[model samples]
Target: MQQQTGIQTNPVAALGRSTISFVNSLGDIFLFFLEGVRLIFSSPKQLTKIIRQMYFIGSKSLFVISLIGIFTGMVLGLQGYYTLVKFGSEGLLGAAVSLTLIRELGPVLTAIMITGRAGSSMAAEIGVMRISDQIDALDVMDINPMAYLVSPRIAASILCFPLLTALFDVIGILGGYLTGVTMLGINSGVYFYRIDTSVVMADVAGGFVKALVFGIIVSTISCYQGFNTHKRTDSVGPESVSNSTTAAVVLSCVLTLVSDYVITSFLL
Candidate 1:
């Protein structure tokens, strides 16, 4: 005798599951951004917290960023000089360095640095709080977690990133100068002149805008990942920190690049 087995399935089940997942993800992202905006306008009461975070995220990370920026600029100048020399256009080296650093590289690199330095820490700290019920403790005490935790970090990012980018821009330009004039023997006056002429307020403005947007993205994503650490307290271990960091870095990079294209297209 052959036994017949019944196959049980719902045709729309997969579709419904996908739809709900998508909607939930969208809602999470929306709320993340909304919380950021809400914190932006809340008050000045969190100034002390914001300043401390700025010191951690911006001031403490300066040495690393400056070192990276210098090397990046030097390499860019050397490569650009050689490439431009092929066409007897080595004089354009300054313009190349300034344009690349200010328009694209500076903001993006600073953001990446901050992500590795601060974003991971932010996520891990908040994730631990969530797992340990510290966040719930705040709720039980009538303290607003959004105001106390997320707001200060968001504010700090907004204030810190642009400043860091500007610092990177200056350090990068100096490195390019050293490479162009000292290593390549390009005339100092010509180098500065070309850079001055090539770079404008619009370029600086666009880059700062990119930095600000990236800051917001990084803060929101990291905080959201941390805040959502509910079900799996044990699972919110070291691996969760790594996952959150990876997500923040990847998302920040994608958003920065995409926003760059959009901003440049609109501005130009």
Candidate 2:
């Protein structure tokens, strides 16, 4: 009876332990994000690193962002045209496409794309460094790895996300113009006029705000996952790195979408 009792697991204890661990993880991630963001302004030397990351996370992503934006806008134009045509309001396609792009799809899609491309890279790179002891080496040499590694990425993301979202919005609008005006016989002047009349500064601001939030979420989650790769319970070394990278991308995207809804509700 004593041995059986000793070997038995307590469900309540297990649940409590799991809850505690989850809370501790949340606290750790929050602190990690604070430190990373705080260090972004620690020195002017970080400018170089920030610029490099911007190139990787922003400039390199332009083609894909533009491609996706155009197709999304084209599809929106098509759907909006058909839907509004039923009521003789097909001319409003431009307003529909522009508003949709600027208010929602633009920022969300841009963030998701960057998360897939750069967020995964960030996690994998840092995870590899952690497993290989490179991060520890930096620590032993008195280097602040979070500053050296994470802060610049976060800064770059903050700077790049809004810009990318803006680009996507513009390209998407042009795509709508191509479909609605060129292909579907929408009056060019009417198309642009509707867009100019329908969109306001508040709509634009809200999209940028969402982009900013997504940037912070993606960069922080990616870095946190990678930074703690060695602590993963399920795997070690390369497998752990891979797992972290997957988690980073998945979590970043999920959070970006969830935050989008929250931000939209507040903005509205």
Candidate 3:
């Protein structure tokens, strides 16, 4: 009877353990953020390292970002022109394209592109280092891993995201110009005039702010996943890396949209 009772309760016990583990993971993330904040203020000498990271993640990512931006803008112009012309407001195409790129598409698309390019590489590298105990070695040598490993990434993301978004905005606008004037036979002068007149400084500023925040979210989440990597007894570090990458992408995308809405509301 006792043996039978034990067997019947095993699943319930497993469920309870799983719940506890999930709660513990949440706690770990909160603590990680706290530690990150502390280290960010305490360590000023890591700026150089952060700049290097920005060069790799942001500067090196320009080509892919430009490609994505150009295509996205071209598509926007093509689709927007058809819809606007249906309403006899084809002249609004330039404003529509610029607003879309500046207010929504620019920051979000650039962030997604960066996440695919840099976020995965960051997670994989850090996870592998964690599994190999190199992080432990740094700790032993009196290096704060949060400062040396994580803070630079956070700083880099904060700086790079805005710059990348700006680049995306330019490339996207140029693509829109090509599509609207060359392909769609829209007046180039009117298109440029509408875009230049309708887009305010506030629109551009807001997009850059969103990019900056998105960068922080992506880098922080990816670093957290990487820093906490543990080699599964049956699995490998690649699994952790992959999971981290997915988390970074999802969280960054969500946060970007959420922040965009909030900022737009406040500005309006």
Candidate 4:
């Protein structure tokens, strides 16, 4: 009966277990995040480590972010022009593209891109260190692995994401301009004018807020996943690293989207 019960679990009991597991996971991640933050402000600052992380994360990510932004803007311009032209409101394309990108796509897509580009790498790096006992070596040296490993990453993400988002917005706007003005013959003056009038500081502020929050979430979740990987059971060489990396990327993206919706609901 006990063996059969394992196979045919009670729905209520299963749900309760799942709920508890999820809450516990959240608490673990949250506690880890706080420790990272606290370590950032504690004594013996790791300025060099932090700077290196920033360069690796922010500078390395620029090309991809720009590329994605350009193509995305072009697509938006093409589609938005078609939809607005049908209603004879094609001039509003500037406002539409600007609002869509600045208010939503700019931050969300940039974070997702970073999650793919950097977050996975971070998780894999830490997972590898953990597997190799290098984290233990740091502990033996009396180094706070969380500070050395996690805090710098969190700080880097917080620094990089907003800048990447800003760059994305700029490049995306230019791409939209190329499609709308050069190809479709939108009045350049009217396009810029509409964007200027329609996109206020509030829109920019909201995008930055989203970017900052997304950055923190991605960094912390990725690091936490890497830190918590079970070396003894899960370490199948690179499989463990790759698995943790994949989990980090997936969780970062899900959290970004959910948070985006929640932020938008409250802000807009």
Per TM-score, the best of the predicted structures is 4
- Model 3, 133: alpha-carbon shift in Å? 0.3
Give Cα-based local distance difference scores for all models. Answer: 0.83, 0.94, 0.83, 0.91
Where is model 1 more than 4 Å wrong at Cα? 1-23, 40-43, 231-238
lDDT for 142 (candidate 4): 97
Candidate 2 residue lDDT tens string, 1-268: 8866754676777788889998998799889999998999899999999999999999999999999999998999988999999999998998999999999999999999999889999999999999999999999999899999999999999999999999999999999988898899999999999999999999999999999999999999999999999999999879999999999999899888899999999999
Provide the TM-score for each candidate, comma-separated. 0.88, 0.94, 0.85, 0.95
lDDT of 4 by residue, 1-268 (tens): 8977885687877898989989988998899999998888665577778889998899999999999999999999999999999999999989989999999999999999999988998998898898888999999999999989999999889988999999999899889999999999999999999999999999999999999999999999899888877542555777877788888999999999999999999898
Where does candidate 1 have its weakest 10-residue lDDT segment? 1-10
Candidate 2: minimum summed lDDT over ten consecutive residues — where? Answer: 3-12
CA RMSD, predictions in order: 3.7, 2.1, 3.5, 1.7
lDDT of 3 by residue, 94-140 (tens): 99999999988998888878887898777778888898899999999
Better of 3 and 4 by lDDT: 4
Candidate 2 lDDT at 146 equals 96
lDDT of 1 by residue, 1-268 (tens): 1222221244466677879987887698778778766875677777788888889888998999999999989988899999999999999999999999998899989988888788878887887788778999999998889888888888899889999999999999899988989988999999999998999999999889888988887888777777776644445565665566566667766766787788778867
When summed lDDT is taken over every stretch of 10 residues in candidate 4, the lowest stretch is: 228-237
Error of 4 at 38 (Å): 0.7
Runs in model 2 lying further than 4 Å from the true structure: 1-19
Highest lDDT: give the candidate number.
2
